[model samples]
Target: MVAFGFTVANAVAAWFAHYDPVNIGWRLMFAFAAVPALVQLVGFLFLPETPRYLINHGREKEAQEVLHRLYDNDKEWIAYEMGEVAREMRREAILRQESGDEFVLRRVLRTAHVRKALALGCALQMFQQLAGINTILYYTSSIIRSAGVHDKITTIWISCGISTVQAVGTILPLNLIERLGRRTLVLSSLIGVVITLCMMGGAFILINYDSSKINPAQAYIGIDMNSTNTNKELLDLCFGFRNCDECVTSEYCGYCSLKEESSSLPTTFGQCLPVNSENIQHSLYGYCKDSMNNATAYSFTDTSCKTRFTALPIVIMILYISVYSLGMGPIPWVFNAEVYPIWARGTCVALSTFTNWTFNLLMSLTYLSLSQAITKHGAFFLYAGISFIGFIIFYFFVPETRGRRIEEIERLFMSEKEITPERNQRHEKTVSASVI
Candidate 1:
């Protein structure tokens, strides 16, 4: 439900961005988030304190009252639950006393089960980021633009579609987790992610290659290539054209003119003038040099290059987000919380969360730079490779904790051979019998 709400917010923001004239639509979207935050604050004020917290703080009468209210005045269940909570609190106190003032981090590091849990937790978080979901989430507009979507409104709408698919995908795991199990869901999700990322990368590669073929001439004082002669000699002449040393001849040469008085005038192509005139040196194309200052020098002729794969990239992006939302998006945190013992669970989960945020920050900050360093296609290919590696790691090292108690999970991780087929069969039988 929370993920659904978040996607709805993204859709609304995209809608705002589509129609915003001054480009401040994204800012307005962020500003609107305060509405939900304020509502949550007011809601929290009216919520009653939990019975367990009251019991732990020595407010026994309040704890009993809250328990009775929670159980709808069912004295039997309330008494049983209160005893259980008190016993758990006593056990926790004993564990703390045994640690004898040792730092929680140090104690966590010393315990084998806790240490392994922390390692797996951190690795899961890191792998989640390496899957490259943030790349799409943070730069959806730029990515769609690169894929040949020129209209801002179209790009934003496409992004909203991707977010909607992601939200819908999350629903599957809610019902499937207990039946299909964590390991299967995560592995399947990663496989889907790898395949979708490869397809997206391939689509971009085709678009970029076609774009290059259409516009071979570099952005020199932009000259329209379609209007120029196609002969090799003429092409070579245009390529070799240089800034004039002086404004001595009647021949036209690229030169910069003063800033145009009107806002609509083109800036790249200025009026042609002789070499070294007061005009700025702009380009060497004769036509550009001869044209008026406001003339459009060279509008990109390769607008059609992306048309072939325009829908392809968007489809791939939606598929990738859909696959990710299935299990990889939420299961890692679930596993992180469940794997640790109660005494160290909080610290371990905090460290895992820190790892997630750190990697998320790294990916968001470096995505643009990496895309420029290695073309967009290469970046996605690299991410796909990382996801493949993550899948292998999870398959071999991560254990399924479905239907298992924390103590059982700890034991499974502690013993090297505990995940063998024989042990799994025995564990399943035990769980079945317990349920019966």
Candidate 2:
């Protein structure tokens, strides 16, 4: 349900556009998110806890009751499920008996396989955030604006379309995560992510590269700064820029395309005039500045340039979201739940969940700053690099847990590739003896 709530921002924007003209639509959008939160809070009251939780909490009868209800009281299926859960619980009890500690955290850290599972779970969460999912979702409007869309209503509708695609695309994972397996889906998604990120980055690079070819002298020939209270700093920051992209991306600048050169936006190195705060539709200074009479022939844009490359990013955004939804978007949470041993599952999953949000907060806080500092394309490139590294790590580290039981997953973590402490000690001694 949360996956589909992205369109609510557009809904709130629409309401603000129609019923209210106060410009508080953005604040209301945030307030509206609480609506779903409240709904889920109310809805969960009637929802049953998962059978595993009941089984783990020493309520086997409740676990069986849930399985019966879930399975339509199918006796054979319920028995099979009860056996699996009970057997896993019994095995975990035996292991804990031998480990000499009753504490979940200590046991998780001490057991070699649980430790590996915990590490892998945490790493997956970190990589999920590093993929910049939050940046794409949170800054969809800014991204659309940067794609050369200036009309608020048009931008809002386009954003709603993208959000709808994302919300619907989330359904793909539920069907695919089973057949494709956890690692396969994520690796596949990462491949798509790397490719799409590079493509998106290339698109931004093209926008800047094409705009940079325009000669500023030709584009701003008749344009002149205001005669009074002229800002030299603004001149250097916005006017001194050579490209429409550089100007439009700056928070305080608007690109003013010379009327004669408007036909060839690719080469029309437009003037970067200071933005009019009162009315962002026009510039604060120069021939492009707002006027009731004697309107300038120049076209102005604060968010983006009037360029042909506008539609490319929109297409790429849809493609990226589609690819992501089928894999990395939802699989990390599933895999984290599947990997840990029963004895350590709760503690380990909580730790990984904490890591997921911590990194999410970190990325959300830094994405815009990173984009501003590195340029949008450069930021995408950096994320692509991080994703490439993630690809390699996940390939070598994450095990397929689709059909595997918790016990089976625990053993996979302890498979031949895992070097036990005793094995490491022996290997070290052999190396030392060889040196002698």
Report the C-alpha lDDT of model 1 over 132-228, residue by residue, as the tens digit.
9887887887788777676767776777777778778887788888898889989999999999989988988777654422112332334445764
> Could you tell me which 10 consecutive residues in candidate 1 have the lowest summed lDDT?
241-250
Alpha-carbon lDDT of model 2: 0.78
- Deviation in angstroms for 210 in model 2? 3.6
TM-score: which candidate is best? 2
User: What lDDT would each prediction earn against the true structure?
Assistant: 0.70, 0.78
Residue runs of model 2 more than 4 Å from their true location after superposition: 8-12, 19-24, 27-31, 41-103, 212-228, 258-269, 276-279, 290-298, 415-436
Quote the positional error of residue 94 for candidate 1 in Å.
2.6
Clashing pairs in 1: 246-275, 246-276, 247-274, 247-275, 247-276, 256-280, 272-289
lDDT of 2 by residue, 1-436 (tens): 6566777666566666553435566667667778878998999998998887898888889888898889999999998887776666566555566566667797778778879888989998988888878788888888888877877767878888888888899888888888878889999999999889898899998888766333556544444545566665776677567788877777888777656634533334357778888888787766677772323567778787666799998999999989988888898889887887555777988999999999989888887778778888998899889999999999998888878765467678785766667855643553343323
Pairs of colliding residues, candidate 2 = none
